[model samples]
Target: MAPLESVRQELSQQFPCRKDQIQVLSTLFEASFPSPPTTVVHGLEATGKSVVVRAVLQALDVPHAIIDSKECITTRQLLEQAVAATRNSVHQALGTGLLHGNQIKCETVNALENHLEKNIKDVPKFVLVFDGVDRQKEAPMTLLPGLARLGTIIPNLSIVFIITVPNPRLLHLPGTPHIQFPTYSKEDMITILSLDPQDIFLERVDEERYDYGEEEASEDKAWLWPRYCAVVWDSIGKGAARDLRTFTLICYNLWRPFVQPIVDGTHGTRDFSKLLVSRRSIFQGDEALTGKIISAKPSAEDQNNRSKPTFLELPYYAKFLLCAGYLASYNPPRQDKIYFMKSTERKRRRRGGNAGGRASKHRKIPRHLLNPSPFSLDRMLAILQSILIHPVAQTGQISAQIATLTSLRLLLRTGAGTADLLDPATRFRVNCSWEYVSSLGRSVGIELRDYLAT
Candidate 1:
């Protein structure tokens, strides 16, 4: 009781805003037995799932092993790693318990089952944590169910899963209770990051200051870091790096220079307006927003490249699919048979002619100016097949490419039935502009104006 209370008091301060999770995990493990065979700890990446769980176990001084799921590429590898890690934990906790690595032979699940049933009788309550098992290379469906069943089957053992994606389908079995670590709120993030104020000038010792300036300077830095974090969140974190890890990295990268003017005595800490005006590049630069390496210094050529608008890098077929979507939206359905016969016939187009001349002089609205109309999946597919010189080997590949385009928002799925791909009439519209799609067409050596029915 004293130990649990002491650990609770200590860990609560070490990890702010995770009191509930710490309490739940502590209670579960401190009980007569950590019941229910399996406990799931799920959250978005960098939300402190792994670190919090680790802190609790270490603070409790409990026997545990955290095996990274990335290390387990196959079920055989997973089993071997699991057994070795479990045995190592038992030895660490009890000092002289459980069979050693060489003594326990496990190349398969059955061998592991035999070893566990025969040799794990004298060990204390142990927790074996698999971090990011849901993201492992081996399929979680087959791998996890078997592992969860093992936890149920084995005595004096418990399994914990730390996962990024909180999919219920993967955790639909009995006796599996999950703990969720939500994304950090603005206040919590600011509080957590205020732990260490960056050394703007790297705290150079040779640089001299006032007698009590050390104390006052420390006070000022503490005051300034939280405000800087707030400004960063308002300008960048709210839209781009919401996760703690990336947000923290970005802050560390930018902090040194952001406060250099203040350190030089040119601007006071409160003059954030002057600082923002002088360092406007930090806010508007694409490298910070586009996920370039945090500490990476951009070359002169890279800086030149950043000045240009970012181009979406798509798969070879995805470009054609997007082009077809644009054509289907702009061209009249009646002209489809004339321009693009069936999949078998060659497309008909005059060498130097484009249907752009077919527009009415007083047509109220230019086709490009009007919003795109929705076209069926079949219509887009027909246009895509017609435009290509060679027939695609399989439509499964095409369906996948359409899904990719939809995700990138180049093609927007329309109509009310939840955008079911199984429905042949699932309609989509072009979300790109004429100039954009026209440039895309020219890149692939096709003129988009030749197919328009304006």
Candidate 2:
């Protein structure tokens, strides 16, 4: 119930430098009240760029106008909205509606210039924070020139434009200062987590049924403490600092239901088994480990099954992981237990097809893979099935494959594959053992015999 302390802490850590920047600009603005504005802070999303500007304004105790650049419906709409907001905020603050009575019929850039020149007469210094600038249709290139021209027309109108975007390089704004948003380090992540109140942490602990048994409690401080750290770390590593807010929300959601029941006396420590099962359910379904083993047979309707599954058609992240795993197997210094790649030769042998068959004319090679032509996903799946049944390969190899397959299943179940999998920036790496993989496959209704026989 207490306001989140981390937000405040993050603000405090960022405001000092930002305050100095605002202070200098404020001084210049005060000197140029009847003249043009000066300075602009611009950067991408989650970079604390907007936060810095807002914090500065707050510290200065000076009134400023903020235009939420994300609200526009289209490129033209964006320009219109921005100009309108700028004029309205200035008009409201200065008690003068210089451009209010007349319908200023002009282009976005020109109109904004006209409003600034005509309306900002004799007023003291003020700043404009343009958050969500990337959401605009155009890069505000026209507005920039207009802004520059204002300095000559009105010497005292010192204006500092703060533009927040996801990509700074694309802006091409001249004479503007660019700031890069830093990625959150592990220590930063921990600090962010620590900002949560003691009650929140306790609630998460209780909800997850994280209490240790008498024997384990005496031996260690927390139940599954290492596992907890790994999970939190993994979540944070999935994206940049902007994602921290979402990561915290996920933790809160995961912990909320379990803790509330305990507090209400509707649940107790004896119900830990159910809580454990529930937590597992959040990540993976109740699928047998054997289900992950790939198997293939000439289908009863084989004539209709001409299309092969290609890796290119797969989500980008999945393809990247599969490729990384395949490459890792041939190479060394692997992060996982063992990476696996299904041999095309083995698949041909199992299907009684020629091992030296000509490359298919229709197969399209993905741009990332240098190969002239790439095997389809169905073909890859078939090859994987063959590897699962190979006598020369250890059962552990097959098991490991099954585990990777199971992780993929979990990703799909969580709907993570829909977006994250499609993103080129996202990738997956499984650290599970073969035994666990085999166990997971069985849970999902796959049989070891099917894998071995095929």
The model with the greatest TM-score is: 1
TM-score of 2: 0.42
Score candidate 1 by TM-score against the native.
Answer: 0.61
C-alpha lDDT of candidate 2 relative to the true structure: 0.44
Q: Which segments of model 2 are wrong by more than 4 Å?
A: 1-44, 74-76, 79-83, 95-104, 138-153, 158-175, 196-231, 234-242, 257-454
Candidate 1 stretches greater than 4 Å from native: 31-34, 97-107, 204-209, 290-454
Query: In candidate 2, how many Å is residue 157 off?
Result: 3.8
**Model 2 per-residue lDDT at 119:** 51
User: lDDT at 370 for candidate 1?
Assistant: 84
lDDT value, candidate 1, whole model: 0.77
**Tens-digit lDDT track of model 2 for 166-241:** 3443434455444444544555554555543223124233323755344543233233332333354554334422
Residue-level error in angstroms, candidate 1, position 425:
52
Error of 2 at 388 (Å): 49
